[model samples]
Target chain A: MKKIINKPEDYLKEMLEGIYIAHSDQVTCVNNDLQCYVTKTKKEGKVGIATGGGSGHLPLFLGYVGDGMLDGCSVGDVFQSPSADQMLAITKEIDSGAGVLYIYGNYNGDIFNFDMASEMADFEEGIRVETVLGADDVASAGPSEPGEKSTRRGVAGIFFVYKCAGAAADQMLDLDNVKRIAQKAADNVRTMGVALTPCIVPRVGKAGFSIGEDEMEIGMGIHGESGIRRGKIEPADQIVDEMLTQIIEDLPYNKNDEVAVLVNGLGATPLDEQYIVVRRINQKLETAGITAVKYYVGEYATALEMAGFSISLLKLDDELKELIKHPVNTPFFKQ
Target chain B: MKKIINKPEDYLKEMLEGIYIAHSDQVTCVNNDLQCYVTKTKKEGKVGIATGGGSGHLPLFLGYVGDGMLDGCSVGDVFQSPSADQMLAITKEIDSGAGVLYIYGNYNGDIFNFDMASEMADFEEGIRVETVLGADDVASAGPSEPGEKSTRRGVAGIFFVYKCAGAAADQMLDLDNVKRIAQKAADNVRTMGVALTPCIVPRVGKAGFSIGEDEMEIGMGIHGESGIRRGKIEPADQIVDEMLTQIIEDLPYNKNDEVAVLVNGLGATPLDEQYIVVRRINQKLETAGITAVKYYVGEYATALEMAGFSISLLKLDDELKELIKHPVNTPFFKQ
Candidate 1:
């Protein structure tokens, strides 16, 4: 694959520099390495918000770091989690005097690294560090399987936790309260994605997976993991219904429960199709008697040009609703 | 190609319904048949902001209509312009006592229909209507052929105008002032795009154009128009330089000129690649003695699943800088 870069290894560093330059007023380089871009605001008594995971997903980890959102975000190589040291550095920089809260997706590498970093911060720096892992992809593991919780991966639904955690932090909520809000958002949320085509990793110069022109993989992970099922490409409305039904069944949300629906285009799905899917999904929600208090349709969390989308539903209450509705100024998602 | 719609004709209408549901508190459906979505806020005595175009590009027209941006947006069939009647109705609904300002990208169909609607609004309703067409794609047409100015096609650079115009309107600038600012933004702007692969229009169910794996088309329009040059897919850095050279030369921004750079992903380019391109572009600007006051990198305006990107630069002065820095609360762009 032809890519524009001085060296493949230096790609991430150069990209981070560009992000900091564009958002200089709002963001700054955390360390000399330039992997982490952090917000300039510092609150002595507020909980510090830290989120990080992979590089290709922009406006997610990087674009989300600003006022009313993340305090710091550490970016790794494409689709790869940052090392424990990198996470530790970012946590240390943003700790302020108050406790630091690590809100990240529930991917294995990220979980392990963040956990290690939190422990390191607690022991070495005497900073209180708490974490909330987002595991909202219902398709990653089935209910029938035991000891499969570890296998359940985090996808785009992680944004729900970010919003909740960010709002809590902005309001100067304690670490425990922030953790609770983040966990509540994560637990109430469920997502399932389908991939019409595979994404090519620039370094690899090949597709992460293979799919025929007429087929699609349902419940595919953002990083191109094998999906739960594969079949011929079906109508968009049917595909949306199937994805929504799986999520609804997994969560089994009550009829009166209010929810925030996020119909996210993975990367390559056109806004045309995303809106079409959202229409059917809204119909499904109405039929089930669920009140969609808040709905977001866009490429909130995306795979690199993976022609597909995911439906993430976060069952909302007074607190979650307020948090999600809180005004955020990010490069990608702004309210 | 499989899609998620029940009926092809109902796609746009259903999609508009979904958008309203997502942002119900902020936007409402003006006309179900026309797929017209209008913002709830009606600023009295302010130049009513309005924009509309095709449907596949999200956040462009629909996501952009909100508190500080557009008052209404008329979504067309995928990659097509709205009818004159649709534009007229939206213009009528959003028109406050002051007047309605039509801010649109320059496309043959859109310009013609919007012109017709403006005439009707003037003759029928006596509502003063002024238009500022976004003609930022410098690569669309070469130096003026005898008796003709360059036919600059509108691409992603339209977002810059939206920001400036919205800010002007939000500040209650008169229609003439708003039009002047928007036009200045449009005139100062220049963009160049290249497509690695053609997009697949949902309505058409086929690729918009053909390209081999190692091929690319430079100066391609948003809707898969034939480019000025077709060549082998070059490195990302080279592609960025090529695009930047054309924009820089066409606009001829000087050393003392402050500018806002928008390195927009045309849907399918990964964030990593976008950052890589931005890094190089920033260096080029610095080397040219140009000061980049603001920069944006994301899928702001897109050609559905077209694996490409465009660079937009607007020479900024005091007024332009203030407008660019103004806070906007649109669903897609928040500052």
Candidate 2:
């Protein structure tokens, strides 16, 4: 309720307008609609990668649209999915001679909308569009059933996917290679989160959920997707251990396996605390003989003003490593 | 109060450990103290730019240490000044024949500690460390006298000073020019914030202050410093108009003045809301015929999880413009 927003209904529209103004040099509003903001960094004969999702998660979908990153982003209302029309418009806007790739979090709404966009782009406009779904949230679905992997929601690990895919695209890779790299990035990533408090949806003027003072929801998805376990909040070490254990084991990262670690905040958590969690994660990785080659810590993806954090591990190979290391100059995911 | 910290007492120590671990490639802890993280990006005979302050402000003190940016930074406990020892050690470590420049926000603790470090660095290490105190927070103090400008507290606008000063330092400007540019940046900048909710200090486990559900404090400082006025929380446009009016007029910014605007989140406010604030800010400037040459939004400086934002305008010149657009890469800040 204590938000600096205008009309709740205009939240998405106004937010994108602001972003376009702030980053006008790097991006432009596509189709005169605020939902789709395409980057001015797009190059001819390069694969155009796009990602979009609900609003409120700053730097999530829109933050990656820039140099060495996504080409366009279709935004939705806070925690809601963008319309297929918006996505299709962005696909057309970003598509060069090369094809377009849709990379996004694994959510029902996003899947439906992006799928529709893909079909419409291909059938209606004869544009080639491929999809790479991200379902890295380990707690949303278990690894015990491989078939259910797609049921998992995406979290902070999507950033890893975006980086690799974006970098690959930036390297002027072919469309097939870009999709392959994106899928590999998606498959190699895993994430788990803890929510200290629920975020209030601006329109709702109330939190999506409530918790006791000392309680936290472990493995909560970005949009308050039901977490697996809720219990009394523990210390930083305990929380990091519990969350990272699942993420590492779920990915089955083993000895001598190199990876990138991202300790991301879920809105209100301070970067200092995220770094604390990353410190523990690095120690844990060292003890396990799993080398964490690169580390990113901060609010990469958020759930409104929720006070929690997520640990994402991307099992890395030389290709993924090189791709991630490629300089990215986006407003959010800068290298 | 909810937070993702292990122990309030260990917050600073743990946070620094995390930072060292996260950015080990680009930075290193100086003198075995986690508080003083110096960048590996320092070049021989280049004026070192060092800034530091309380721990809670993300990317304020520590985040700017990287290539083409700050050469060193010393961090303090949450909302507390770092010890003079930490500052002195960094001054020594980053000094590469060229003198060092100390650019930091104007807080009492920071001023006292940094001044001590400056004196010690001069006496013990024979290093030249000129100071440019950032007192751009327009609301913290009034212009009581001609020389009372130093009485104002620095807020998010300090980032502009850092970017410009760091860029100048990276250009290998001599100590005097670097200091002059830093002072120019400080003098040209002004910031005013509105606070919706106060943040809780970890040790205290309580908010610094409280506000009614429907109330907001305009001109509030990042650390809950008393603002100019309190009133019912208004619409986004209303708040932006009120805050921007004071900031623009205080600077007495003219119709033809070209400026850079930063609509920064205090901590917990969503990016969408910050954008909304920025949109209004940009519009207001345009309406006044003042050109906002550039815009920077997001949480440049935060007060823990305080739900508010500040608007900062830096009267820009050709020198400042070129310096700001200079390429710099750091973990938290990049352009």
Candidate 3:
């Protein structure tokens, strides 16, 4: 593998160690456990926002823990779910007596562990815990009906859910209110992705999957799961159009709808390429009469060094628009 | 080649189109020239800081143009210097009678063009333009004497110079003071990098260079220029240690010297690997009794999709410490 890591077993631990060393002023581990990281900003009576998932996707679960965002995160190995104990530990650390909300992706292992953690937190510490699973990857599962509860694999669109929910929590919203906002964000956002290359988990020491020299995969999962279509590489505009079409149709964003567009690079995709994709998205949206009010183009979520990009759109209302604009300062994300 | 682009010849234009579309609120093209981009925040009395370089490195030259940072940038094609006319246009757009400063990398083509632009601006518009070229890659040239003017190639360490200079300019420092701070930053910072793989320029449609699958080139330039050493890839710690050792000795940093550390990804290098490298740098600095007061770890300067990372250290004094902390809100950079 071309990865700049040491022993395969040391990947996650060393990364956590580095994160703590670099951001100690803003974040800390719960009871010195690296797997349970929490923000140092403790505002009493504010509803706690907690998230967790597999590693590899930086700035997603862990990188979002800081001012105006998540309060804590349970970290796991690359593409592997964190243990329930780790999640529970994070819950105990972030809870400030206003209850804690669990926000994470809709992966089977993560769903299982986060649910268990919620149960354990309630049983062991009498902490009220709620959950909101991000299921915004429209390619994973199409919405059968409008406003349906999707089983879609969560991807880059989870960031919007975190932003809305975190802002509500920071404003000292009640648990039910915060959960409502989180659910709203979960319902409104949709994402679709294309991959040009595969990334290897350090332990695996080889690419998880392979693509031909001139090929790309549409709707590929972050962990190299089977995509909906695998074919020869298309132009950036064409690729973006295909992805955005799926996302727009999935949400069926109406004419005159306002959106916050996120053009996310998987890992190795350059910012230049992401912007090119953004240009196409903007054109498509304009043609569809959907207005893009905000643009976030960069690597927000990634799969190791995989080369590709994802397009996520969050259809916004007045409440969601105001909440999304709320300021945030985190180790990886800031506004 | 595996790239998500349309026409290779249209790469730079398309990328710029996307950038303008995404960040039009903060930046604008001067006189309808896409190659000349300037910030929209006009402060009449503040010193205008302008920078430019090749197009591939995002969040570097053009990305720095915004509030509290660069006021303008002259954009070039991939790995090529922008035209002198472009520089003059940017200088004219940003200058508000307080004068403008040209801050860019110490590349021959850039130096030649920016110098010409400065002369043209002074000759035509009576706008004073001072220049500070970032020459901080210690691996490119060794310091024969202490505090010597390096002829080294500019690399990721240029971001520190931009931060320091931009902050100084934003604080309404006179042209001389801003230029002095920029020079101070340019002199004190040092960087070294390693590349695991080569990147292909779009128009070229082939890898710029090649290395063995298991080998890495230490101190490789951002543009794939030859480095000081080539060998089998080592652990992240070892690579970081080697790079840090050279940076420390080049400046001959002493015990208790405070510094701001920047672990920058070139392109394909993942945040996980960069953090692993950061962990080593932290440990090494601690062992050497150097205090690290700030950390900026991410892709600040990149070479398209090259697989590598660079380590930069700005030996910070109180003045630089305060200036670096000054607020900045650019499209790609925010603090």
Candidate 4:
């Protein structure tokens, strides 16, 4: 594997050490534990927003912890879930009278660990915690029926959930209110992706899967989860049209509805290619009478050095519109 | 070729179209031409900062055009310089009576065109214009002796020049003062890079250079330029040590000197790998007693999808420290 890394075992640890050294003024680890990180911008009586998932996806779980965003995050290995103790430590550290809200992707291992951490925090520390799973990948599951939580896998659209929920928490919203907002964002956002190449897990030292280079896997998850279809690669506009069609139809975003577009690069895709996809999306959305009110085209989420791209659309109301525009400061993200 | 693009000839046009659609609120083209883009956040009396180069590197030439940064930019095809006329158009559009300052990479084609633009702007439009070429790549040439400017190709270190010069302009410094700060940034910063893979230009439709599966080219230029050495890829820390050694010796940064670090990814390099490099740089600088005052890591400049990374250090004084910390807003960069 042609990767810029040391021993596979030290990958996550060294990455965290580098991050801590670089951004000590804004972020700090919990009790010197590299697995648990919390923002230094904590405010008393403000609801804490915490997120966690596997490593490799920088700016996703840990990068969100900062001013006007997540308060804490527990980190995992390459694609493995963090321990419950790590999550509990973060929860306890971030909670200050106002309860904590857990915002993470809808993955089985992550859910189990976060749920266990939630229970331990309540039973052992008397700290209240709420949960909101980001399930916005339209390919993994169909759109939720009315009054039903989605069963989809979360991908890049989780950024919108962290953004809106974090803004709500920063506004001093109560735990229930913040959870409600997080859930609303989760419900509104939809994502679809196409992978041109598979990424290698450091420990594995080889790509989990492979395509014929000139081929692509449509709807692949960040962790190399099985996608819906694999076929020869197509042009940028055609690929974007396919992804956008799924995203719009999944939410059934109606005429005159507005959205925040995130054309995220999955690791190795160039930013220029992402903007090319955005060009097609703008044309398609304009034709559909859906106005994309804001555009965020870059790598917000990724899968190691996988060569691919994902398009996420967050349908917006006045509340979400304002929340997404709220100021935020983080190591990876700034607005 | 595995790329998300339409016809090869249309690549630049479509990319510009997408950028205009996404960032219309912050940027606009002069005379409705995609070749000349200017920031919308223009002020009447503030000195204008203009930069230009090829189109492949996002956030390098064009992405810096926004509030508190570049006032305008001229864009060319991939890895090619924009024409003199396009540069002149950008100069005319952004010059708000104070003056326009040109800050771009040090390259033969770019220098020729920008100098022509400078002459045209002065003789035809009576607009005062000054130029500062970024010659910060320590790998390209040896360090400059006292009273001499180094002859080196510019790489990602241009970002530091933009950050300092743009802030100086935003503070309402006149043309000469802004040019001085730009030149100082160019003089103080040094960069070195290593590439594991070569990128395929869309028009070329193939890699410009190739290496063995387990090898890397040290000190390669962004556009497949020959490097000082090629060998089996080493561990991340070892590679970083070699790079940092050259950068330290070039600047000869002394004990207790402060610097701003930029561990930039060249397109296909993962962010995680960049941080791993940063980890080593942090350790080395600590040992040397140099304080890395700030860190800006990610893809600030890139070579299409070349898998590599560059380290840029801007030796900082109190003035540069304050200027680097100055708040700015752009599509790709923010502080």
Interface Cα RMSD in Å, per prediction: 2.3, 1.1, 0.7, 0.8
Candidate 2 displacement at residue A318 in angstroms:
1.3
* First chain of candidate 4, TM-score: 0.97
Q: Give the per-residue lDDT digits (tens) of candidate 4, residues B1-335.
A: 99989888999999999999999889889988898998888798999989999988887889998888899999999999999999999999888899999999989999999999999999999999999999888788955687675578999999999999999999999999999999899889999999999999999999998899999999999888888889999999999999999999987677899999999999888888888888999999999999999999899999989999999999999999999998899887898
TM-scores, all candidates, are 0.95, 0.97, 0.98, 0.98
TM-score for the A chain of candidate 3? 0.97
User: Model 4 over residues A257-278: C-alpha lDDT tens digits?
Assistant: 9999999999888888888888
Give the alpha carbon lDDT tens digit for every residue of B1-335 in model 2. 67777888998888888888878888888878888888877588999888999888897878888888898888888888889888999999999988899999887888889999999999988999899988898786655876554678888988888889888888888999999999999989999999998988889889998899999999888889899999998999999999898888887667788998888888888777888988898898899999988888787899888889999999988999898889888877877
Location of the lowest summed lDDT over 10 successive residues in candidate 1 chain A? A142-151
| TM-score of only chain B in every candidate structure | 0.96, 0.97, 0.97, 0.98
Q: Residue-wise lDDT of candidate 3 within B155-225, one digit each (tens)?
A: 99989999999999889999999999999998899999999999998989999998999999998999999
Candidate 1 residue pairs that clash? A3-B236, A4-B236, A4-B237, A235-B4, A236-B3, A236-B4, A237-B4
lDDT of 1 by residue, B61-163 (tens): 7778887778988878888899888888888998888898898887889998999999999999999999998888877765776867448888888899998
lDDT per model vs. reference: 0.82, 0.87, 0.91, 0.91
Q: Candidate 3 has which clashing residue pairs, if any?
A: none
- Which residue runs does candidate 3 get wrong by more than 4 Å? A142-149, B142-150
lDDT of 3 by residue, A1-335 (tens): 88899999999999999999999899999877898999989999999999999999887779999999999999899999999999999888888899999999989999999999999999999999999999989788954687665668999999999999999988889999999999999989998999999999988889999799889999999999888999999898889888888888886667899999899999999998998888889999999999999999999999999999899999999999999989999989998
In model 4 chain A, which range of ten residues has the least summed lDDT? A142-151
